[model samples]
Each structure stands twice: as structure tokens, then as C-alpha cells.
Target: MVSVASPVRQSESRGSIEPILAVTAPDMKRVNDLILAMAGSNVALIPEIAEHLIASGGKRLRPMLTIASAIACGYTGEAHVKLAASVEFMHTATLLHDDVVDESDLRRGSKTARTIWGNQASVLVGDFLLGQAFKMMVEVGSLTALAILSSASAVIAEGEVWQLSAAKRMTTSEADYLAVIDAKTAALFAAAAEVGPVVAGSPEPVRAAMRDYGRSLGLAFQLVDDALDYGGSAADLGKNTGDDFREGKLTLPVILAYQAGNDEERAFWQGAMEGGRNDDAALLRATALMRRHGTLEATIERARHYGEKAREAAASLPRSPSREALLSVVDFCIDRVS
Candidate 1:
């Protein structure tokens, strides 16, 4: 297995996102109130399912990014709150859809809405949340922000479809995987952060900087998630440890291992990824191969590269508590594996 003694342990004290939380707490409260209010519908199941996932203990990182970016850009208007809530709604909707698509049972240590409500209900409720998200964006009245987020929604959907195509395909390249994540994950992060500067009416350069920061941060975040799937436990992921392997998904570690494996090992990988030989024994063997090849460590190193890019982008913004907090978030994303 990959060593549990991650390099992230070197700076454990700097990994907390508390600074951003402290700076954005007041705004987050307003955003939370708006989220709850908008989530309400006469159809009881709508709110029930939405609230289940919303209140399920996710860090609300996307919305917080929006709020922090706006504040960092000197936005004093209420528009950022609406945009932040919109970003969160978009994220929540994606999660509900993802659980159904992945046939997942758990999220953030709670039963997924799909498990309790059924796939049809989960999908429709996700649609409802998307509608609510668009409504909030329209309420914000920033055409630029609306366009950015609307485009992100399309890109996220496309990314999901792309991931489905890549699933169980061992031939997937590193570039292909990066493209999948850039569309599915980084698009929202970029939108969430860019919307802040857009609503704040910051210059194009400032908006570009925040967008770059969010994109790089998002790439780092997802790479770590991919690593954790193989290297960490169920509690660390809030789901079963070997879900990726069982699902036949081709994440970074598996890709690297497949590339480095000799014929016998490659055959094992082919059988495993092709929907055969995927029991606990197979998972154990898969993890062992990854450890032998150090793919997990290499994956984390790639994540660190993106983390540094995010930090550099954050450094370009005007200095403030929010800016510093945003910088810290980059480290937190990379260091969480420790």
C-alpha cells in the first residue's frame, strides 16, 4: 500500500481552512439562509432530499470560494451572497446527480439521497436544484456572472458524460484524465471564483487571476481525491475505500500503474478494469501494485504542482485576509492526505 506517512504532515499547522471560514462566516450565514429558503418547495420530497445532501457536512468550499473572491475584490454588495448560494446549489445538484450515476450509497458519511429516494427522484430533485440555482443567478442581475456560471453548468454536464465514456477504459491517457477533471470539477471552481470578481466589477486581469487560482486549486483538489481513493480509508473519503477500482474507473494511480506494469501485471489490470476480478483480493493487489510503482506518490506530486500554481495565482491578487486565506486553501487541499 502507499505509505500513510504523507509529506503533507510536514506543515500540518498551515492546512486549516479556518482563516477563510472566519473571514466569510457572516456572509456564509446569509448564504445559508438563502439556500434553505430557496430549497423550500411545497413538494416535501424536494426539500427533504436537497436538505439531506446540503446539510450532510460538506465543507461548502465552492461557495466559500465565491464569497472570498468577492470580498478580496472589494465587493460590498449583496450580489456576491446570491452568487455564492448559486454556486453551492450548482454543487449540490451535481452531487445528487453524481451519486445516482455512480450508484453510490454514501456521501460525507451519510446515506446518499439516491439510496433513500431512488434514482428518478434523485435526478429530478437535482434538476429542481439546478432550476433554483439559475433563478438565483438571474436575481443577481450580473449578465457576466450569469454567463460564466451557465457555461460552467454545461461544461460540468459534458464532463460527466466524458467521464462515463472513459470509465472502464484502461487506454485513457493522463491528458484525457486531466481534461475530464478540468471540465467536471475545475470548471465550477473557476466559475465560482471568477463570478466573484465579475460581480465585483473588478478589471479583467483580476477576474482572470481568480479564475486561474480556482482552476489550479480545483485540479489539485481532484488529484488528491483520486489519490485518496487508493491510499486512504472510507472515513477519509466518506465512502468505501475502493469504489474507484470496483466501479472500473481509471484514475491517475491506476493509469500510472498500468503504464509501468509488466505483461503479467498489465493482464491483471486489464481483467480488473474490464469488470472482472474486482473483489477485495483484487483491490488489495491493485493497491500493492500502486505502492510498488509509487503512482500514489507521483499523483500527490502532480497535485502539489497544481497547488503551487494556485498559490501563485492567489499571490497576484491584492493582499488581504481573504487573499491570504485563499492561499491557505491551496495548501489545505494538498495537505489533507496527511
Candidate 2:
């Protein structure tokens, strides 16, 4: 069990995202330099919107995944640096676009770029970053790495559209939910880790191992975020608590809760979800329902299952510091709930 000791400090920031910061510090700086250089535009609004979100308090975990995966697979070239920057740019662009789609104001505890600059600017800047990301991928001159990331980009878009269709629909199933997140979130993670081995020309077994690890880790990360959005303080979640509820997004917690609930409980869920009720009282009732049904606890247990998959995926890799760090990353993802 996670000790509730130091709850204030623990909830203030993400502990899992903080650990490898030291090990990846130097490489992260290089990635940042590349990002800054590539983000520059003659048009003033482009840089403003891009930098606003980029400079915000995100963990940069995805790019670090790319870097760490490459290092673990024993890469020793400058290409991974550019790929890391590319991964970050893709992620930032997605955030810019996502804020617009979600109509969210706060992101990473700050006003989103779209909130400050408006949706038009946010979208255009996101496109600009995507263009820059492709340019970097081309510059790296690796077809395998390029294919992995490019396909992931397409899959992420598809996932978002699928989620858009599924939003707040009472009929949305767990299988549908998993499919959405696998495309939307986990694709890049799998690509991020696999591209490392691709860049390193590692054997197929190692490449497959890294891909599995990253995909599982990404699922755990997102699932933890889902749980936190309901049970956590606003400080624990960079975004406001119940933002997902307010947004009418159907995450695993609510999906499971709805499925397990009875006639009256199902009626409550339908009214709240379909009617778009997002008040504090409604949220209290929702939390009470989740607690009573044990859905919240069940969701966390599901996350632990994925975390175990991540660990098992790494079991066959040749032991190294990078491998150990990647393993710890899984625990860190799970530990965010603490």
C-alpha cells in the first residue's frame, strides 16, 4: 500500500516521471535544443503556441522513453538524439490538438496554448510541429524508424476520432475503450521503444521486447491517469479533478462502474452521463458509486496487470543500467497512485 504520508508533496508532482530525469538529463537538454531550433518560425504565432505547451510542466516521458529504449538496446549514435526530439515534437503537437478537441482550459497546471492563443493558432502550430517532426524523421535517414513513427501518428489520429465517436455513449464497451487507447496513446510508446532498436539495428527479439514493454507501460500510465482524475486532488492531477467527467469522456473507471451497477445505479449513470451533469454533487454521487462498487480499486488492479506485463516484457533483455531504469519506469507509472 502507498503510505499516505507526505500526501501534499506526493500529489504535487509526478514521482514516476521524475526518476530518470538525472540519467537522461544531458540527452534531454540536447533534445530540448533541437526542439527549440526546429520550433522557430518567421510567423510569430507559431512559435508562441508551440512553446507555450512545450514549456509547460509536462514530464517529457515519451521522448525519454525513446532515448532510454535506444540506450538500452545499445545505441551509440547521434540519430537517437534527433529521434528523441522528433518524438517530443509529435507529443507536443498532439497536446496542442488535444486541448482544442477536449475544449480543455488547464493543461499541466497552466492555461493551455489554445486557451491563451485561441483554437486557430493552436491547430496551425500543431500542424507546424508535425511538419517539423516529419522533417527530422527524414533527416535521420532510417526507413524503419520513419515508418514506425509515421504509422503511429496516423494511428493516434484514428484513435482520437474513434474516441470522439464513443464519447459519453452508454453503449461503449471495454473492448472499444481499450482499442481507443491502444491507438491513441500506446502506439507512440510502442513506436518510441521499437524505433530505438531499429536505430540500433538490434536483433528482432530485442526489438519486439522493447515494443511490448513500451506499449504496456503506456497503457499503465494512461490507466493511472484515469483513476487519478476521479479519486485524486487537483494537485495530484495537473488538470482539475473530474475534468474527464466534465468533458463527458468515458474512461475505464466509469465504464466498469456502469457495467457493474444495478438498475437504479445504471439509471444514475445514464442520467449523469447522457444528460451531461457535471456539478460537484453529481461528482460526489459518482465517486460514491465507484467506491461502493469497487470499480476504482478494480481499475488500479488492471493497471498493475499491465505494469506486470511491462516488467515481463523486459525480462529477456541483456541486463544494463538503461534496462533497469526502464523497469523502474513501470513501477513509477503504477506508483503515481501513491
Residue range 128-152, candidate 1, lDDT tens digits: 9999999999998989999999999
lDDT of 2: 0.84
Per-residue CA lDDT of candidate 2, range 258-290, in tens? 999999988888878888876788888888888
The whole-model lDDT of each prediction reads 0.91, 0.84
Compared with the true structure, the alpha-carbon lDDT of candidate 1 equals 0.91
Give the residue spans of candidate 2 off by over 4 A: 1-19
TM-score of each: 0.97, 0.94
Clashes of each: 0, 0
TM-score of 2: 0.94
Alpha carbon RMSD to native, model 2: 3.3
User: Which portions of model 1 miss their true places by more than 4 Å?
Assistant: 1-4, 7-13
lDDT score for residue 332 of model 2:
80
